[model samples]
Target: MADFTTFLHFPISRCGIHVHESCYGGLPVADPEETRWFCEPCQYGLIEPPHCEFCPSRFGAFKRADISGRWAHAVCSLYTHGVTWSQEHTTTGVSWENLENSVFGRRVCTACSDKIEARFGVASRCESGMCKEYMHVTCAQKLGLLVDETDESDDVIVAVPRYFFCKKHTNQENLKTFQRRFEQWEKAEGRRITVHRRKKALSGAEDALRIQMRETLEETIREEDRGKSNGSVAGGEKIKQARLLNSSTEFFDRFETKAEDSGLSKKEFRDPFYDIKLTNASHVPIGFSKEYIE
Candidate 1:
């Protein structure tokens, strides 16, 4: 099923485009006449992408809801603490309501070693629950932080980090934890593949078995007919019943044999990640935290 909550489609003049809720929130509210609503790209006849007001980037830019002719990246606005949308659905207003300058002023980008300037650069915080580190969007990308970019639409590319651990947190222990998780995933994948192959083979075997059973039944009926012609109908009926019962037993036995051969009767496959308990209220995954499940 399509997740309607994640995205919304808006008709911009003649062109229609699907945008994320966060991105849509940053856009200016549509005029009374919906037909007059046009995106920045269509509104301004610009060949090049518009620069973001918050960051020095052209990608994933959305018009600031309050400020006319000003734009900011959805990722930039989201990670920037105190920034919020006015509406419940986030379809209209975007503003930095009750923004604490102390937090913004104090945050020094770990990647670039620069202070996060006011109303210009947004700081993306470290993924570690206890860490108080932050980094700029471009700086994070340049420093090889796990930046995940998703193509939201043909024109919009939403880029954000999957996880951004500070230099202090990025250690051998975390690497080992990641490796362990990956190994578990590989094992799960292997089990799935084996199960699929076994099912396919079992299906083929059942088909063949059905054909054989049909042939046996046809032969038995022919033999019964011959016996009837020779005046031995009662004997033929007993033989036919015995053969039918045997065939039924053999069919069930094949299923048990297949199950044993596939090793499905042993231990069932289960995802290892689900067993892990959250270490803190932040709900950071096992590999990303210091106190992860072994």
Candidate 2:
């Protein structure tokens, strides 16, 4: 007699697997000892419409496969049942939430895939089950995920079901907030006045985003410049550099203009003018050249 662990989360307990079924919502049948389960008593079983892998709660129940060595959950297997190995990559450490929708074909992250769809109003998916990413057809192009690839169909990568999400997507309350917001948005979009207001808001947001990007770039450039100068002298050096550049530009502008107007470029003015005497004959007049020539 094997002891059944009752410490199972929702639908997966040892009682659900081996021992008494009815304990923790497990309907494991003791009749044939084959562990047969009907829908009426399943702990996490869905009803009617098929339970989508992307949805938190699906409509219909999924039949657990006895894949022998496959110990992954029914939800995990339903989407990514075939993937065997995983490769590592440098990523932003964001989690993916499965989005439950008809257009996205039942298996895409809720936050990334659904938000993009809702915002962009487009629908598309990757080539196959192993591709593991979704986007609006245009966004996929914008984000550089998919671009003219006839050979893309041949490349096979393992698609693991990702349940992870960024901070925004992780909070159920926050998601509800967003849902409410979008609902309001949909209602508001119906009106011309609201549309105008939304356009203004979006414009302001774009402007803010541009400003933020500029600030970030400027800060990064400043940090790089400071890094190149060793901390001790960098600040002083930067000030001196600014002053030097200011003075040089002011002084050279007159010379540059004269040189250009004289039908000569700066490069042309260099070596020839180096040999030609540039004198400030403040006291000496141009007529003094007559004495020398005569």
- lDDT for each residue of candidate 2 in 166-225, tens digit (9 for 90 to 100): 232222233444445445543532452333223322245434433443344334434544
Cα-based lDDT at residue 211, candidate 1: 46
State in Å the error of residue 43, model 2. 3.8
lDDT of 2: 0.28
lDDT (Cα, tens digit) per residue for candidate 1, span 187-209: 65455434433432224543443
Candidate 1 stretches with Cα past 4 Å from truth are 1-38, 44-48, 102-106, 113-120, 137-294
lDDT of all predictions: 0.40, 0.28
**Per-candidate clashes, comma-separated:** 0, 7
